[model samples]
Target: MTGPGRRRAGAAAAVTAALLAAGCAGEPTPSSTPEDNRVFTNPVIRTDAPDPQAIRVGETWYLVHTNSGGRNVPVHTSPDLVAWTAAGDALPELPAWADPGRTWAPELIQLAPDRFVLYYTVADRASGRQCLGRAVAATPLGPYRDDSTGPLVCQAELGGSIDASPYRDTDGTLWLLWKNDGNAIGVDTWLWSQRLSDDGLRLVGTPTKLLKQTEPWEGSLVEGPFFHRHDGRLHLFFAANAYDRATYAEGYAVCAGPTGPCVKAAENPILRSNEVASGPGHASMVEQDGRTWLLYHAWPPGQEGSTDPGRQVWLDEVVWSDGKPVVKGPTQGPQPRP
Candidate 1:
């Protein structure tokens, strides 16, 4: 296993090379200059950082992903989103209800300057299903603590719940979106949403069923639901198909509100498998300098399930055309930086 120090050193060397090339080079050519400081290439994080969720706090960009490398929740940090350095595990210890080695899809939300809540999916030993849990910390890169005796959300009848993403609407209302793990038990997978308490430690009122898998490309499941409000509209983005297969892709829907009557876009799979990358889904969006970028993971072409490099992190530009988001990637070659 690679130590955290070694990972950081390797990332620093890559950044140094990128900076030097950008500084010394005159004009960028296809062969001579593939990447520069102003530009970047795919697989920004060339490790197993699947189900990536990123949040920008101040000027620093902090990212956390599914359990990998023996850590409960592997965390990384970036300044410009191109070069990333490993920051160790965010959730170092699991709660009493959770079983070890099954933590996944950690999503972060900052309520106050001193309060950060991390919602994560973990295996509930008592319920024998994957369930949702939340942890509290004072900073982005946290040794978050979950002291709850039970899960925050676990729809065991619908095969439990995972991929808990938090969203704060324009009206100052907080909502949580997630998918029932029905695919785990041969049932229908539905994206659901409900209001969250002000402190973000508990759910409020009743949960609404948002949407489900009906498109051809979606196959039997739809997970990783997140909300992005643009142009006075609430758009729900999700990943579908088997996560470990090349057919896994991303799509979106337009919703009426936080608890929506959502309509799927005509362009169902806005992002899908390409020659450069495969299984491109499970994304989080970040805005910097008025530009939107999608931070997601993809398998290297023809290596859909390899554990060596695993699902590496990739960044792509989200260009809005006629009020709809069009991802300009699974890009292989160099493109302008965020």
Candidate 2:
């Protein structure tokens, strides 16, 4: 995106010291850069940021990812991908209505300079109810508070919601997409969407079933539905399978129209990992400075490779070739958003 700004001198140094100490205690040290002139970058959001979402504001970049623990969801801000600092959680404490483990796929879209509408999967799994939830805050670094105590929306039992994402189309139509279990039909998971109210907290109408998995490589978990409009078409990107191996991938469906009965692109699994980076999915796409970037999580070689803690926040430049986006291999050094 842009070059990093100078931290507030002493105060930043102090906070950086505290965060670095907390980070390095059990986190992976900045990996060595490859000898082939690559860079070795540490972390932007070091925690288990399962669903990393990115957006660029003015010259500064902002990121938020899922915090399954119901703690404050993690947020990072920086001018460039390098030198990110903890901005603060959207909510340090969950609101009274938000039950335990309700936060998943915390995504933000800048409705205005100071206001943001965060869409997430908030549920009480124990009660067998799942729904899409919303929070609004005056600032990006949220202590986001939910105005609704009950679910903004809910679905059936086995269709328990997860991995939700947001997209605002060219016409200013707000859309929300989420995953519902597909185990019954023998598919991985199904992607569904609905138009959201202008405020983002209400549904304009019921969700329309968009696409399902039929490709062999996508496995049985066709989840993580996020739509990025490129060229004149819409690319619906999602994850498949258990996100713990190279097979864990991001698949895409191409729609001639923004909202569609789109077909999976022939390219299919557009973003998958190899031995270099495993289980890279649940990605968010942001176009900044005439460039596209995909922010997701993965297990780097020999570090945090265990699936126990699941995935962590990661970033890579998305190369455009033949109209589709190819997320490059893991990045070690900082790169401009361009």
Candidate 3:
């Protein structure tokens, strides 16, 4: 809800106002179309793709995510969104400006085939400089780098950080959706966006506020913003509530275009777990083999801490229509549906 230009994820700030935003239009949503939307084939990739990001390269589906290991985010590829194999870590060297926290929330965009950009949050928890950085590799999986001007976006104090999802509309104007939070240190947390320079990296227009506050079911945390185009509308999917509690959820929002005053649907918590996994948030969508699937992290019923690297990856078939996504349920593994 601010002016446009230089969009930065603020650190340690307060909410500017109550986010009382709602959905728009009575026009029929295309997410309801029976042909474009199909019944999902179960459990494609089961490896932990925390805050996963994906790109469709030709007939192949490639996925990458926040570093679940000691290094950068890892990339995995598959044909049907099921039966995946690891390619490699996206980045190997720790960014010079990066802190001990390594990297968080890895996002990928296919600006063109064989030419892709991987963006992530590199935080030096000690120095407290949370930065948004980029790495470019000719292939989907590679040894990506801090190839940008160091940080595409950075906030150090209380709310300084990164996690970016880029969108380009039919008009050719590119947009970026990222998290902003840090009220403890005067930073504000919400969804923010900005126009991109022709290259798709530099900030062009001013930052626009799209979403804030959130549904009560989401508790207090809001993060992991992923967007896609469907039936002429833009849909936003994000993780919400606390990270270590059962109340965590993956919610959704929809807009007609990139620059929205976007809207959240009442039927949120699109992908949530009431079982032992505490909270299940931070998600990404992959449109593969004539269908859509969702990837995110959950406690998996037996884990207790977030530091564990083997958080079991869960898959769900997403019903994307009407500018919104609906998750049928979680798949146990790669078994043929009955």
Candidate 4:
């Protein structure tokens, strides 16, 4: 963790770093009780970081996001979830079949002891399609490279697939979930799930459709499905609407098992645009210090009544009230950090 004084004196990049740090850099965080250490502010990182996904390795946390250009996926590390610093690009280069400047939603997961997997979406230039690819590395913060020259999954008929996420059940069954992008072709996006081999490099089962963009709040898209099992039920948190617009929001569904016959929660769009922020969606959830927290991207308040050009990453606590999950924010003001 970075000290308050040193963080305040660091460069402009340091200021962006402080926005995501644990304590208000020079201001004292309330420490009246053990819970006080979890208090911090929002807008964890004020840069254009979208579709943020994270994994906890031992005592450290590593996060990766949608980096369309530059190197492959970039990694950010933090001792406590509140303070984060750019580690480096996870994948040194793109796969030979995909084009650069098109990586989206890079997800990191540890399959076994020191083995980690990096799943991401990239655009194929030759075919003009978007596809999902997987890379492997020994460490969470990676210099991961694709073991194969081709993508692990691609939907040529439906155009392509994006937002690849892996879900491991209590029974140790690995499942891969992703969306077959149909928005451009005038068809609604479909969320699909299939079983993955133990190594996470091979698909083994039949693909099942989970949900699609049918609700009015979801607009024309429903992508980025995150899976979590709690209270004897499987919950899938997904983002809706256009990623670049103010209507983007997150909704969830409750399922009987890993592959369902799932049903959407009646109270849809659990997190949406509020007065302080806009376009809050495409989030990743993690458990830290025994509390669950959400990391998502939202556009800051725009100037002259126009939306901000870049989306910034924000973190908030997820509290279950009366056994139902609720997000504590879309907070613009300083709040307790995770």
Candidate 5:
């Protein structure tokens, strides 16, 4: 565990208007800071930051979280995983193709030194169906633009889709994994993946069905897919159950390839609610200093004096034993910073 160390201008300072380009609206707002980052604990941001996906650029870590119906995607940057500060919005302006006030679960990746791609979920006005779309930017924090006035993937027949996660194989093939949202139509939400062009802007093949909410522990909903590779096998981690419910948890599947006939662990939901937090799900994984860490969201224990709070981000270390991933907590007490 390390302290926040030295602070830099990019993340620790306020974003100026000149840093943003056209279509993006709003000046950067300051994020409230709490206790010293030298020795921090869990619930990293201490505020609502759900479905967080983090990307590392040198020593700095940038995180993007879901902002349903918000003007732009919220971004946070941390010198150390334990101490985070607000950077700015990823998309200064919402994509024109999407209905106003409909953005959700955003995943940003760098394709080249100056090329960046953002994958997010939004809704269509005609069908009111949530779908996945793409935006491009010159920098990590940016005024992103959706060049196409359309979605990259929208399966109206499957009740629409969301939570666009990406995986680049060792061979340089790009693959996208997402959940076919069937919850609105009284059907099971399913995880699906398809190959993409090297540019990651176009789908290459028919989507492959990976997993469904069949396990008793998975409850009625399963969304938020994030992928990683370990021991030469692909691991697909996803959030399950209604996010507001106590049963919300994190489960994973081990597969042979990017899109696969995956096998869910018999002992499912590697992470779940404990005595302190009620709902813990929608996780993103990052490896730092040879240790794997999981960043997730959970509703604080409702009876513990919180006012029915929404999901807030939490961080914990993950240890792999016997080819399985184990999370250290839903820990509420203070511990060493990660």
Candidate 6:
């Protein structure tokens, strides 16, 4: 979900000003070096990095998040997940069909060593609804380009589609998962999936409706759907409830395949609001040294929708016990680096 509007340049400048102030006070400035520490705290990225999606290329990790600071897709890089530095805009230019300042939930995937595909949500001016678009880049931090005259996916009749996430199966089949913007029009919000072409440029088959909000804790909607494969089982993880409230939390379903017959866990909302953080959701998994880490955004407690330090990036471990996933956060204390 998008946070309050703020320019990216302004945010960077504010951070710089604070660091300079600390130096003037004879305090040691924080280091960006990944090896500076063995333990890390919450809000790994202490800025407005909402709806974060990350990928590891070699030893460096690259992250892209919702439009802010006047970038279509703001990109950041790190030697380790705890310390991040701004890497500039990934999609510097939006397609002809998209309206500016509304880009959100960018999902990055690598098809080859030099080929990267980004699926992102943008406002469709003609349809007056949010839609999905695709872009390509040669490197992880890209000046990715989209030359389409129209959106790649625009379910206008169902209030348009958003939150496009791509998943690759064990058999090498590519699938795209997203949430229908039904909440925008007061309709039932359903998570849908479809097959993607090998090139990652287009959808190939009919869309399948996976699941929708049914539980009370989910409130009226479910959004930000992504797939994770663990121990030969496919799990569909998603965020539910209102994005701006403390009730916004994350849940998962055990799917038989990418296109499921899926079942939500009885103990749903596995990762949720705690004393340390509020509304922790929109997560993507990264595996390092055989351990899985969830990279997500969270609102600072008592500051649910504030623009300052809005939706900072948080890292938590995901442990599997008896084949069920468990989140070990929103941890306030320092913990081992991923």
Off by over 4 Å in 3: 1-48, 124-127, 183-188, 276-278, 302-310, 320-324, 333-338
Q: Clashing residue pairs, candidate 1?
A: none
Candidate number with the higher lDDT (2 or 3): 2
For all the candidates, what are their Cα RMSDs to the real structure? 6.9, 7.6, 11.6, 7.1, 7.9, 3.8
The 0-to-1 C-alpha lDDT of every candidate, in the order given, reads 0.83, 0.64, 0.60, 0.75, 0.73, 0.85
In model 2, the runs with Cα more than 4 Å from the true position are 1-47, 68-70, 182-188, 301-310, 331-337
Rank by lDDT, highest first.
6, 1, 4, 5, 2, 3
| Local lDDT at 209 for model 1 | 97
Poorest 10 consecutive residues by lDDT, candidate 3: 11-20
lDDT of 3 by residue, 1-338 (tens): 01110111121001101111122111111221244333333323333445666777877767776654344676777655544566656787766666543466777876776677777777653446556777777777767656443677765553765568887778777778887755324444677787877666688868777776556886555677877777777787777765555666788788656667788978887777755344566777766546776667666554523333223455666776554677766544333321
Q: After the best TM-score superposition of candidate 3, give how far the Cα of residue 282 lies from its true spot, in angstroms.
A: 1.1
- Backbone clash pairs for candidate 4 read 39-336, 39-337, 40-335, 40-336, 40-337, 68-101
User: Evaluated with lDDT, which candidate comes out highest?
Assistant: 6
Error of model 3, residue 263, in angstroms:
1.9
lDDT of 4: 0.75
Give stretches of model 5 more than 4 Å off: 1-38, 68-70, 303-309
Model 1 Cα lDDT, one tens digit per residue, 115-227:
99999998899888889999999999999999898999999998888999999999898999998988878889999999999999999999999999999999988988899
TM-scores for the candidates:
0.90, 0.81, 0.78, 0.86, 0.86, 0.92
Model 5, 1-338: lDDT tens digits are 00010011112112222223332223222222357434556677655556788888778888887652233577878877766766667886765667644567788888888888889887766567888888888878777788886788888887788889887887888889998878767777889999988888999979999988898888777888878987777888988876666777898999888778899988788898888777787888998888888988777776221322345678888989988999998876666665
Whole-model lDDT, model 6: 0.85
- Please give the lDDT score for candidate 3: 0.60
User: CA lDDT of 142 in candidate 5?
Assistant: 74
Off by over 4 Å in 4: 1-38, 303-309
- For TM-score, the strongest prediction is 6
